[model samples]
Target: MRRFLIDAIVYVRDLALGFSRGWSRFFFLPADPTPLGLIRALVGVLGFWSLFVIGLDLHDYLGSQGWSDAAGAYDAMPPFGWSLWFYVPDSLLRVAWLASLAVFASMAVGLFSRTTSILAWIVIVSTVRRIPIALFGFDQILSTMALYVAVSGASGRAVSLDRLLKRWREARRNAAVVRPKGARKVSPDGPGRPEPSVGANIGLRLLQLHLAFIYGMAGLAKLRGPSWWTGMALWGTMNAGEFAWLDFTWLAAWPMVLNLLTHGSLALEIVYPILIWFRLTRPLMIAGAVALHLGIAVMSPGLAEFGVAMIVANVAFVSGTWLRSLVAGRDDEQPALRVLYDGACPRCRASMALATAADPDRVVEPIDLTAIDVKTIHPSLTAEACLRSMHVVSRSGKVESGYDAVTRIGSRLPLFRPLALLGRLPGVVQAGRVAYNRIASSRPRDAVCTDETCGIHPPVSVTGAASRTRDSSAI
Candidate 1:
């Protein structure tokens, strides 16, 4: 019995330890602050728009003797509800409102980001609490994001004026640092760039959890209604005069289609919270959300802004890596190493994909030699040279070829770095170059080799077929 009791205690302790470790990893792990910055930029626009609209009729709504007095409106709210307008005199109301706009604009641009974020939160809550009668889901989401955005400096760390200023400063500071001649001026990913932060992860996790709870609760509430179960819920929404913009009355003729739409939406909402956590399903769910909210924006004029707010809130789940890929072409995009390779070689294409699939920062940009004229792109590149050897172009104009190119590209990717190191070994590099040349020279130069015509390439170099197989793993 004593041994049994000790075993039970040990098991409980182990279980608790596992739970604590998992929880800490889930929330406290450092993450890129880009998503928070994105959320802040979007929420700032919504807040500024709401405030601008309110500014149009300030006296009629939020003034001391407006339709709803601050005291009466705020009193109905939960305890400790407050508004800056309550203390501001009527004569100075316009001035205070303008100042609030400036604060929101600062938040939007990410100037002194954390300070502006906190101020924006206070402004949103204060105004909303002061005029509770005009509240909507849009207001609620705006307030929610405002609070979360204030939780860390993440809201301004990227996609902000602050980042731009930091870059400008770094450029000036590093102006004297010598760079490779004829090389592209690439900034190293060390300082003056968005670094992963634990606070950013905390802020994003809080928003994600809150958003999932909201969606889950909404789905649960819909299940309580017979209209949703019978697939008539969307029908009611489409028929509503206040919400409907376009004529969805024609949906009456196509009951099956209406049922599909209603049922599909219901299922997606019900499963979104549960399935969105998985990497495999997250993209699909996020896309589904975008479609659903876009439909709401188009169909319902009154809820358009609310739908937009929900979509913006969903941005919290998007990863920094995906975000970088989305902006890959921009002038201010992160520095990337370009791989110039033969498009017709399926093996080479597959090899490049394998090497780059795990890249977190989207640094590898593959340029197919067939698709673009190499002579026009760079002076060192020629059709014959590219055909004879694989080429990698640095961010600066420097070029690496054959075995050197493979190592250069591989070294930059985390998983492939060891392969890069192995290739650079004393004997390995010389043998690799010989095998690479043999493989490259064997390919059909006149016609594109289809998969069936591929295997005929001669392994007749000094390295022989076995060495050819070993060294020709990638282009």
Candidate 2:
């Protein structure tokens, strides 16, 4: 048992490393495109805004009465009588409520990210404390988590007006430092010297650790539950009349099927941590989680909102690299020869280098055909043939070669959407592959172009001449 536990810990650690490495390669290492950056900005804004609204509601609920008073008031009211709580507000409470909303909105837009985050946390905590008895588990979880995240400083990466202002200030400072040819020499460590922000890094690490702990705790909680032990809890919950949005009454007639589903849910909940911990099993585990959430949504009406939210949160389980690939484009669009080269090259390292240089956020993995163990990862690739050209293996295990691999990689790039589409035309794919092969053959095996030369350049034309330049340089 001890050995098994040790193995599990090691497996999870490796999985996490791989997941983080993949994301770094895709999103951070590569040159990020404007649109992808915008999407991230939007997601961040929306996430923070949602927290703000929730905080406002909590503030309103708390200001009218104390926790004990609220509980007594709730007992006096009939079921669904809590609607009355929204209308009545104390004078001092009304001011605080409005202030909380304003702060939340400011934080959402990232006006002064660090400052707004701190204020938002204070407002949320105050609200939670005021009406603790009225708060549901989900409400408490969301508010507490938001407070934690706000203080931890997630708004730093998310596109915000504050970041734009900071950039403008820095640019001005840089311009001011520039001098005419005869000006005195500046010291090496001048006033404008860039320093690393340890605060940002520390905050990011804290958020990652907190998210991991949440997952661990949730898994452990399920293990201690009676439903998980008996394999009947999930079934009962699903079949309960209160949650029946869909007519799953038909499913109840099938006892064997119900038993299977019940057992599967129990097993999945119990083993989720272990599965997520393993590199080989992480993808499967994520898929299972999605399915589980979908099931909860279909059978339960009120639960769909919670289920979807949880599923979105579980997105942390997915490698950033994989998420970027899915959002960027489909895999069928790659050039052939580039795919071959990718497969023949080293695993994660070379691909990651290219990805990080191209776009920091949407990095895709390149296949490594050189390893003797490549067959285990990709059974279809024969060791002898994989060496002949550049190859790329998609997540689904489909292989592309030469220019096709370039096209595939390009397709995953937000900036290269038009070129990727053009590459898919019948004769264009073959022509591109032939051109890529010639270029690959000309370059010496030991020579490698820097990212400046080999990375995809900004769009030149719909004809894909710019991509061709980068593809040729990769050889």
Candidate 3:
């Protein structure tokens, strides 16, 4: 009896420990700022759209002479919540509205990001409170994102004007340093770029937890409905003229497919909240979520924004590195392309692996700049330039660098061709180039040779340099 009691206590202790560890890791682990930055940028755009829609009928929505007069706005407020919009006079309401637009603009560009984010949150929540009748799922999502954006430092990362200003400052500082022509100067610890922090983790964890709660509660609510158990929930949603954009009632002719979709959706919602926390099940859960959300967006009219917001929220749960390497289609077994990479850089190595994985036909000859005879293979290939950026040589003896190299390689890969096509668009091409440069700049410069020794000092012999200049003139 004593042994049984002791065993039970031990089991309880182990369970408690596991729970604590999971919570700690969820709320405290350092998260890459890339996902957070991407989320911030998306939410900012969505926020701007919401504000624009409000701007279209600003006076009708908030003017005292219109539907919700100041007194009526105050009356519409929840019991405990307050709205400053009620206190502002009718004459100043327009001014307040304009101010809110300015705040949203600043938030979108990430100017004074944290402060503007907080101000934007307050403005949005106050607006929602004052005009509760105008609220929709989109407004709720915008408000929720604002809350997290206010708390997070996501705006300081890539894709923001804030980051641009930071890079400019770094450039000015580096110019002042007396480093060698080819060497890099490290930024001072504190004032340099801020490292990932627990706050980022907390913000992402909150988003993930909230999504789990949303799915779990939605699934439970559906379970209470007879339609869900009978596999007619989706059918009802489709047949509802007000909710559906497409006439999926035609699907009634395919009862088995309808049943599969209905039961599948319910099962997915119920399973996602539990299984998503497990590493092995995370990809499956994420895939299910993407499919479910995309289906909703494509099939439902008014709910498209809501579906998009959920997908954006899901971005926080995925690895930013994986997303950066995304290829859209299945791989086609093609002949190998000669790929040049900075083998010493872990990110470069990982990228190479991602691009080459699952393709048996492609032979990847990774040419380490430090170990390669630049003169022998491509007499015009300069080691210094290659080290500074990525390079790829096609079988036809054509060379590509930076964004061109990346896109060319991706175009040959089935999974990345679609993105490659998108990358070629006029405005998108410039943006893609800038983003690629940022990633390339982040690679470590203190790269070691294949022998694991400090790489050979630069300035290859005069003859090699001249040969490179002569052979690479076309590029």
Tens digits of per-residue lDDT, candidate 1, 338-444, equal 77776445355545545444343556666667657787667888776775667888777888998789888777765467888999999999999998777776743
Per-residue lDDT for 363-422 in model 3, tens only?
334455545655555667777667767888766677778888888777865546788899
Query: lDDT, candidate 1, residue 118?
Result: 95
lDDT of 2 by residue, 1-475 (tens): 9999999999999999999997664334322122222322333344455444554555445544543465565555555433333344655555655566666666656677667667766655554454555554445444544544464454443335555445434433322232333111111212211222333333333333444455567667777877766656666777688778666667656767776776776566657666666789877766777787788878885666455545544554454334444554323432221233322122223333333233323234333343234576567766444544556777667876667767777776554557889998999988988877665544333223333533322222223221221222222
Instruction: Quantify all predictions' global Cα lDDT against the true fold.
Output: 0.74, 0.50, 0.68
Rank ordering of all candidates by TM-score, starting from the highest: 1, 3, 2
Candidate 3 steric clashes: 2
lDDT-better candidate, 1 vs 3: 1
User: Model 1: residues >4 Å from true position, as ranges?
Assistant: 1-4, 176-193, 329-377, 380-475
What's the CA error at residue 459 for candidate 3, in Å? 23
- TM-score, one value per model: 0.69, 0.47, 0.68
Candidate 2 error regions (>4 Å): 1-60, 65-89, 92-95, 164-230, 317-475
